[model samples]
Target: MDDPRDPRRDATSETAGNDDFGNEGLTSSDTLELEFREALNLANWTSGNRLQELGERLEREVELAARHESEMAPRVLDILRRNLASAEGASVESGVFQLKPEIVLNALRNVLFNGLVEASDGTRVTVATLPVTVVQIGVCLTSYSGDGDGGSIGHRLFRHDIMRRNSAAEQDVIDFLGRRRRRGMDTSAYGDDDQPMGISDMLCRALMIYGERAMLLERSERPWRLGHGGPMPHELIVGSGRKEMAFASLEMLRKLLLDHKRFIFVPSEISDQTVVTIANSLQPLQYAVLRDTTDIIENYVQGSSYERPHYKRSGLYQAVRSFQVDAGSKVLLCVYRASAIAPGRVFYAHEDHVHEAAQIVIADAALQESRGFPNLIDIADRTCRGMFEPGGLSAQVHATLARSGSPFRFLEERRTRP
Candidate 1:
């Protein structure tokens, strides 16, 4: 793990001129500007009258967009509202409908917060010539249950670990991954290839796998605090992204759907395909009556069987598939807008509590009208960052290196930069 950075390489690159890269004789600046203007004129001449036609087309597009926002959106909401009612009735008749908690005293008790890393790829190279790659991670899990007073009572579980690649620590991770694989968990995402990998690339994958394991263990603390004598939470609220809650092993996802039964994954960001579907499905609504209000579209199927090949490879698809298979009618995908102020969000719920999840998100978002994002997720994220300030962690690592008689001059040049 020698220092990958070499000052000689930068010096060589800086000394090399344009001619070294096979460039033709450089033209004068005036000639270059004249050539650019001539090319622009040629392009304009080639376009001819088509530019006017393009302008007219753009005008039509603007008109269509205006119609979509002012007219189509409201009508689409009405149809979605009707469909939601139908779904609710079907769920009730099927004996799967469950009401939201009346008090919601323990609803916000569970939250998953991501770890923070300062260096590129979660790995920092120490020493000047003979460098080693080390990864530092700090993760936290919070449970904020209601107290007797108006305020809330909360507790945080914290863990920190550092590992150097190809060392005993790395071997421990490899063995841990192997054990998880033996237990029917999918570790293919964290697999190694025959080709040589950089320290950053290797550490990136290792960090994700290790960080997820750390998060899972942290979330399983204290049974009494999680309600009903269970180590895991009944309802776990996580942010929307592949790395957030969707990066778990396939077996772990199935266990979450089947065992926990209430893993509420609210993705604040919607997909492009979903956006296109929403736009096309509501195109005809331009002729209908318009209203200004928030609405929900229930049971929105994300991708189709036609695109299974592309989507099946994604972790999100695996998570959604697990919910569909193990959670059955308990699963729901609700697309709802808090208001016209923001776009719609998807709630990938696994307990037939789509409306309730939407309500909680909306209510929490209302409290932070500035961003209109979920306050619970935001607060948890902020808490994690605050607890694990990257500067402090980096300083601690450097201090330990100094104490071990590692020459400060051997440190990477980038680490010494202001």
Candidate 2:
């Protein structure tokens, strides 16, 4: 929804400025990194624009490695190569795949991306060395924090790669689901070309809806103001203090929402009975569930991956579309899962105790504010890019904390204490 200068214009200006320098001027790693960063910027910024052409522009950025960035050639290609491979991989499990920049960076450095992921069906797989340019397709496909100031939601959404739809991945999904159907798993949606359902798909639709909603706002210009709602299991809602819970951005949003704390976004990961359980549990907090509005929003947006076909009855999209925020909540909104998919429930808690599991939540506002909140890891990766490369923020909070200017120097430490 952000309309800054056209990327075409930026590229034109850069190209024009480059005509005189020829191939020799771009040699320094500093220059290569800056340009690569710009390309990365453009890649994320391509949302809401002509996606295909913008994609070419992104590839052109990788191509910019020539001239004098020859040393960075492998790394640049690795970024692009990994992107395609991951796209293919995402198709096999979930109909979509999304990753944050930190995930990609780690994948690049790993001995083949092995330690992080664990799927819903108990499947585990590591990405194994991939590109820096994985599937950034569409708004919901983005990471927790973005490249803008303070890592606000708008900045994250804008700079994250959220492709509208991916035909290839969709095909991969259909093929996988077909195999499932053959095994009698009730893969009904595959009866059509594609279903616009999935965490990423619905999230994209929600954002587009918000954009439309933003325009219709008779009150504030702020689209992020709407409250949120959804179901949650007792362990996560209350706490287990022992077992790690599975959630998308729910808890992170809770801790980060200092003001917007009253809202939550729910996906199709939980059951309907559980939703009712969560709703009942919220009675003490004076919260109530609103009838779903999924049908209303469904008419407005479609699947966001680049080339995937869209169908009418995607379950995941409906879950998000049905989400309603309690405008009357005192200070917090809850987002839990509701499943017509599964017919069951579970609940329990510990506000003082946490699962000791590390979760990374992508959020707006200051990711910095989430420093010590349990169950959440604030990934302000891009924000600290310079510290690692002599290019990120020169004065990161951690750096300042580690430096010392005290008058006394410790004999063993050999420096003034911070």
Candidate 3:
């Protein structure tokens, strides 16, 4: 028979012969079959080379994907973990209400006048509710050199509020301040004289006032271990128009509360609207407004009947300056036209709660004339609103006072109930 697997034959014939011989004894056809097999092996080798190239490419792609995932996974996990921790920390236990650190910090910086709480074991806690409040206050003061030109205290306050609300203005102030800093000149143009108060000085003063109040409130015996306790209900006083003198009074109050470590002094700024709102909001908490715009003795009327009486007298500022001397337990001194009555009034309401007071100040029409006055009000208002919502600083103060382990008794003496 002709060699079926002959290399000279058609390729189909070689395939047929290989299938037919299948392990039979070697013949002339077997030699031809071996050559055919060699050709088939060469073709398989070439195809395998192509597949190997494709496999290598696939392997490289897989390695790249794995590397990318490896790089990104930790970051994603960390974010998720932080979120979980925050959520967990914010959660309140049944029948137990606790303030969050952010809320506490905000109260310290803006409303509470920078109140701090140091634990008995020497853990110092600075309460700040919104990080932006710090940044906003910092930037607002940074624009001023404590000069009269930046505007009156009222104008400065107003500008601060307006700028805080207006994003464009804020950016401008920041940019202007940044450029001034780079140029090594004064950033704030408004001041009493050319020797404007630096923003850093203002910030330091504000922070010092806040820290002082916190230290006093916490009743720390040691200077280094200040702010170890919470607010004392009996020591709290909420009023309006006593801004500047309040800081000085706070010095006295610090002594009063600390000498009696169990006592807490809380000072608040309230407007006519705030008085009514707080009265309505904090139901069952005894409410009274001392219309002491005249002499300290004349303003002290007795009974709950003295709801919203107007005082026809000057020196209301003088009376407020001295009001702290007789303030017994929590007192809410609500004044009408606080800005009109005392334009540059400075008071403390837990540094964190200052944002609310700042809001009130900024909203006053009188502040419009003051440079930078309106800016902080809007910024503080937005921040306070965002943080406390339906319940603002008043709510926070009330809650803190309640938790302060002091007996809160509102006094309404018929002889001294203005």
State which candidate has the highest TM-score. 1
Local distance difference test, each candidate:
0.37, 0.26, 0.30
Per-residue lDDT of candidate 1, residues 117-216 (tens digit): 0110111222213333344444444433332111111222211122225558768788655543443332222322322222332333333333433343
For residues 107-134, what per-residue lDDT tens digits would candidate 2 score against the true structure? 3233112212110000011111111111
Estimate the overall C-alpha local distance difference test score of candidate 2: 0.26
Ranked by lDDT, the better of candidates 1 and 3 is 1
Candidate 3 stretches with Cα past 4 Å from truth are: 1-198, 215-418
Over 4 Å off in model 1, which ranges? 1-70, 78-130, 143-248, 273-324, 327-330, 400-418
Tell how far residue 10 is off in model 1, in angstroms: 64
Find the candidate with the highest lDDT and give its number.
1
Model 2 TM-score, all chains together: 0.16
Candidate 2 residue-wise lDDT at 274: 35
Prediction RMSDs, each to the true structure: 19.4, 26.6, 35.0
